[model samples]
Target: MDFILLSILKTAIAAPVLLGTLAYLVWIERKVLAHVQLRIGPSRVGPHGLLQPIADAIKLLTKEDFIPSYVNKFYYWLAPWLALMFAVTAISVIPVGPVVEVFGIKTNMGQADISIGLLLILGLTGMGVYGIALAGWSSNNKYSLLGGLRSSAQMIAYELPMAMAIASPLLIVNTLNLREIVNAQAGYTFGIVPNWNVLGGGLQIFSFIIYLICAFAETNRIPFDLPEAENELVSGYNTEYSSMKFAAFFMAEYCNIITACSVATTLFLGGWHPIIPNELGGQFLPTLICMFFAGVLFYHALNPSRPSDRLSMGVIGAVILGLGLMFQVPVVKDLAQPLFWFASKAGFLIFFFIWVRGTVPRFRYDQLMRFAWLFLFPAALLNLLVTAFIVAVKSN
Candidate 1:
């Protein structure tokens, strides 16, 4: 059947892309943090370290897959893969763009369009904790046990605020389906600003802020990254893990970050919607951006900072320029623009994650818990109540 084939096709395309993105996200984080500290990151492996991920992958694959004598081998072996599976699975229900016709067959951009998509994400993410907890416990290390317990507690504490913040938007839209949540945020107000949940319809800016804060905690990202605190926990739950298994755990964390950003983009920022209406030249924005980057690349190519740059940079610049020109084609524009907007919004949020890591200090354990329960939980709860009241009044 066409449906089954399409599903297979989507999975094939999305899975590799997601995996590659997870790998590069690590490179991006390092480069960003390095620059923030006035240092160059990985650059020797390949051009500007573009091949760094590949090199790292090879290293991880070839390294010793060590197991501690004291640990439970079965559960220790299972944890990283389990974490990765759930992280990647959450992407299934997230629509990256509107429905489009390709090769005369209509298909949704995402893999699945389940009705209870939000609930599925929540359930899977909640289950991801089992991987971390099991990893720590099975390692039979006191430090790993402490780290695992901390992660479990942190997830439980922050999930309450995160769910409440998510609920505030659901109250406004009156839907549990992720696509419908995005569709409800389609139009603009005053023909200029988008009717996104954060801006127009829900005006749930506080909710958005609360969601982001909780997201940081939920993903165990810095200022709240106590689980893997190197100095405190000696690399935390995966301390006993090595080689490819360790890489799997690292990949899962970035994958979760990507999922969090994607969810936020879909729920609050309008998933694939342009910032302004298409009629207002919003469609041209991507072309303009690509061309601008192309121009910059060409300029650098001409300048030739490094000896190798004259050839490599010039070729890359030409390729970018060609892609920019391709966006002028009506068919290409139609197919690619939605993806562009979705990527832009999600990319910004991803950058924000890295930015926070570079600029913010890690929270002391007690401080992290206190902030989530005392401040974030109450704020999210109040926002949800107010949102419900407003929705009720408006419906009447």
Candidate 2:
């Protein structure tokens, strides 16, 4: 494909895919959280709450766009849009898969193939803080301002650890390009263990762990979500916003979660590489898993606990079975395998975030800040130092 056309094609595909994912991600979280809490969630909106996001879109779009009389007009309006833009923008450089020829046109899976992908993403993530800070301050509400301040502090504290942890892998890969970082981790140790940053060959699990801890904070997720704690600040930094502006902040948070998970997949989880090598029949794993899940769904459909689920589960199962069979096609199999592995890994990380949210309680503002500076930062620094030492020794 022509470079410009491919770029446009990628953007066109990515934007809608992301928006759609953001919608369903909310449904996924709600359903998972409901199961965790021993409750049924959103059952009234479409089959199994599948259309809940559409309802949510309509509601948010129709809600009153009220601007507070006491607010700073321009910054208050800009904050959420700014938050959303930066959150979603970071994905352009992420390598979803290696370069491949699709339909006789060659291209990389990512929208961009920039040399400094890692650096650029890090910078973009750092800049996302401005939105929160501005939203709180511009609201002219005391609690909102405090919430913003806490977020700023939390981010600053965790960022050092995250950057240091990221550096450990950088030293091992010897490149700043995200694609190169992933490529460096291709293949395995003794044809058994995959060379992911968190696994045997790379052995940067400590750094990966540190990075995850910081990731939770950077994305303002559970246990580190002091800035948005309802009990503490009553909607936190975005308290004054209404309608789509509020929804923008809401969507931005999820976008950041997805972006953070994607980065984790790229940096430490081998991007789109299979957890098991193809020689061991890893290529067939996705199809098998998909079929297995479909079977489970079919089983549930036969003995469904909910009346609605009887039909919904069967329909869902049939769709998944169809997808599983499609993965067996020769050409689709090649391209599909890589995308499947990438989605599975990234999907697991995203699930982990939701799982944590349903189970973990928010941290005290003071405790959150202290934990980041006192523990995560020092641990990351040590991990980076040890990684550098090992890589240097191996070179010698």
Candidate 3:
């Protein structure tokens, strides 16, 4: 009973934070784009548009609800909430930081510390696709149908490399729990470099690249954002949705983006771990650096073509945060090292995602289908084979 109550309490707390973070992500996207396009975004709302997300929330809430006459009412009503539910559920398995003892009870940042964290995330993501597809089918419109089909196909295709990328870390740690993975990389070597998987056999770097690329596609971000291609599909699957219904869909999309980043941060980059000063500083360094890096990486990944301003802000923020960590005592200083490396590596991958988004053009339906089938599928297979061989050799 106590554990169940605690789980419920955690879920309640996480719900609001997840919703607010999604809104803030949208605001940051706009701000990053403004910098990319050489214009200021959301200046009128608070300092540098800090309150812009709140304003948008209010506007979305008050908007009149619209329901198309021909639409399947029940399915239409169920789709958005389904999407949000699956997206949020994926977060339960993500371990954001180390456990802290509070009031004789230990609390971890994640909702749960399940061993099959990777599989659970993948499962929820697959479920999210169904909600998107159902929304289109229920709408009974050509555009919505087309968007739904496109998203369904795209997600299936990307799931290949994404799964393979996640497998690399599992290969190294030989466990499914995210907390175990972090613990594995807690220490430093040569009194300097951290012992993260990112620095391990060439597999780590390759896995990181694959995971980050697939993440963009999985989240349906720009470049791979064909489902919601405002120019092509007019608003995509949720085209006919309005009021809270549309807001639910919008929130779902942003939540998926954050979930994607968080999962990637945990798998390849190391979640909530600082880059420098491991165990040297306590939560101070890890929190500041991790947040700054996360913000920068997300912005860069979302807007790679023009991220100079956003990148600059991120670096400055990271430095300031790193300084805070440096001030902590040596006992906990080493603890912050994973966070520092985590930020640096995660930021690089996020920037890489942005660069790919900017440099590469969208794939045609057939091309997208073929690339997934021919390239990513075979590559992932090869990665799995090679990983197995190396593990066998190391054991022998």
Candidate 4:
């Protein structure tokens, strides 16, 4: 009973946070796009558009909630919540940092800390694609149906590579638990460069690349976002939605992006590992430092300035620090620096997402399907096989 109650409480906390963050991510996406395109976005809202998400939420909430006359009302209503729920649920098992002591209980930051974290994530994400497919089919509209079909095919194809790319890290660490994986990568030689899986052998690097490409596809981001190709399919699967229902779909998209970023952060970058040199050590200091960097980088990505600024350099600094902290071997007591380090790495990835969004154009549905099926799928499979072979050899 206690365990069940605790789990429910954690979910309650996480759901709202994830939902709220998704709302802000929408704001962040628009803000970053505006800066990229040389325009001020949502400045009319509170304080340089800080309150824009809130305002938008108000508008969405108050708008007329409608179901198309011909649509299956139950499925249409059920689909958005289903998507949002699955997207949010995946984040629970992902550990944000070391076990945080809340009150008397020493609980981890995330909901679950299972050994096969990757498998859990994969299964949950796979199930989420159905929501889009159902929404389209139930809409009773041709465009929505087409959009749903596209989404199903795209997700299925991309998932192969994504899983393959994910396998490489498992080879190096030999474990599926996210926290253990992060712990394996902790520590440094000379107070610089964290020992992340990215530093592994050639096969690992290849796997990382495959993972990244697959990530963009999995999240339906640029160069792979065929599900809702705004220009061609006329808003795709969500063509029929309006008001808060539309907002649910919008929130789900950004939530998936955030989840993908979190997953990549865990696999390649070293989940929540702070970069401060623990050998040169402080206690909780490193963790705090890492957290700070993580938070800042996260903010910066959401709200970036022009490209010419030295933000990239700062991001690199944070990544290094985070790696140093998470990789600490002897277990650095003062973890204040890591807070900054962890955040920095996360921020860097977020920056990359923004950069990709701005620079790369969306893919056509056919091209997107071909890339996933022909290229990414094979690459991911090859990478996975190689990783497994190397791991077997090393063990022998």
Best by TM-score: 2
TM-score for candidate 2, please give it.
0.98
Scanning candidate 3 in windows of ten residues, the lowest lDDT window is: 334-343
For model 4 the TM-score comes to 0.83
Q: Rank the candidates by lDDT, best first.
A: 1, 2, 4, 3
What is the Cα-based lDDT of residue 75 in candidate 2? 96
TM-score of 1: 0.97
lDDT of 1 by residue, 1-396 (tens): 388988998899988998888889889999998998899999898788889999999999999999999999999999999999999899899999888888788888898998999999999988898889889999999889988999999999999999999999998888888889899999999999899999987798999999999999889899888998999999889889999999988988998999899999999998999997989988888888888988888888889889888777878888877877776787777667888899889999999999999999999999998898889999998999999899999999
Estimate, for each residue in 229-293, the C-alpha lDDT of model 4 and write its tens digit: 87877877888899988887777777777777777777887776645454555344545555666
What would the per-residue lDDT of candidate 2 be over residues 1-396, giving only the tens digit for each residue?
577988999999989998999999999999998998999888888887789999999999999999999999999999999999998889888989889888998888888999999899899989999999999999999989988998898888888999999999889889999899899889989898999888965788898888888899999999888888888799899999889999999999999998899999988999899988889988888889999999999999999998877999999999998888887898887777788889999999999998999999888877887788888888888888888889989999
Model 1: lDDT equals 0.90
Which structure is stronger by lDDT: 1 or 2? 1
Provide the TM-score for each candidate, comma-separated: 0.97, 0.98, 0.82, 0.83
| lDDT for each residue of candidate 3 in 97-166, tens digit (9 for 90 to 100) | 6785445667776689888787888999889998889998999999999999999989988998889878
Alpha-carbon runs more than 4 Å astray in model 4: 102-104, 189-191, 200-203, 281-341
True-vs-predicted CA distance for residue 327, candidate 1, Å: 2.9
> Which candidate's lDDT is highest?
1
Clashing pairs in 2: none
Q: Distance (Å) between predicted and true CA of 36, model 1?
A: 1.0
